[model samples]
Target: AQSVTQLDSQVPVFEEAPVELRCNYSSSVSVYLFWYVQYPNQGLQLLLKYLSGSTLVKGINGFEAEFNKSQTSFHLRKPSVHISDTAEYFCAVKGDTGNQFYFGTGTSLTVIP
Candidate 1:
């Protein structure tokens, strides 16, 4: 089984500032890591993912994450943020065997103007 943990429940940042959301996971077998974002009253959208090869992966909306096998972490980051970036972020993991995915609680990002 695989599980994900997001240490921060909320993150507040000024516009144009950088932000990083922490995510950790545990799994007995190899897994795929993912980051998803949800806007107010909207469905979740894929932000990034780490499937194979390259430790670093980039996704839409200027977001990127690094897969650290040693730390069991896949943290998402943005060099600069905008007010439109305010949303809830979730970290998820899926094992190689099944279609089921384990997701972290979530982190709400508020971009302050």
Candidate 2:
């Protein structure tokens, strides 16, 4: 079984500053990792994913994450953030066999200007 853990429940950052949202997972077998962002009153949107090949994967809105298999971590990072970036981010992992996906509790990003 695969599970995800988000270290922070909320992350507050100043506008135009860099921010990193931590995520960790555990699984006996290889799995796919993903990051999703949900704006206020909206559904989740796929931020990025690590299927294979590159350890570093880039996503929308100048965001990127490095997959560390040894550490079992996939942390999301953005160079600079804006007020509009304020939302709840979730880290999820899906096993190679089943369609089931495990998700984290979620980290709320509040950007202050």
TM-score of 2: 0.97
Q: Give the per-residue lDDT digits (tens) of candidate 2, residues 43-74.
A: 99999999999999999988999999999999
Cα lDDT, model 1, residue 106: 100
The CA-based lDDT of model 2 is what?
A: 0.95
Model 2 misplacement above 4 A: none
49: Cα error in model 2, Å: 0.5
Task: Compute each candidate's TM-score over C-alphas.
Answer: 0.97, 0.97
Poorest 10 consecutive residues of model 2 by lDDT?
24-33
lDDT of candidates 1 onward, in order: 0.96, 0.95
* True lDDT of residue 107, candidate 2: 98
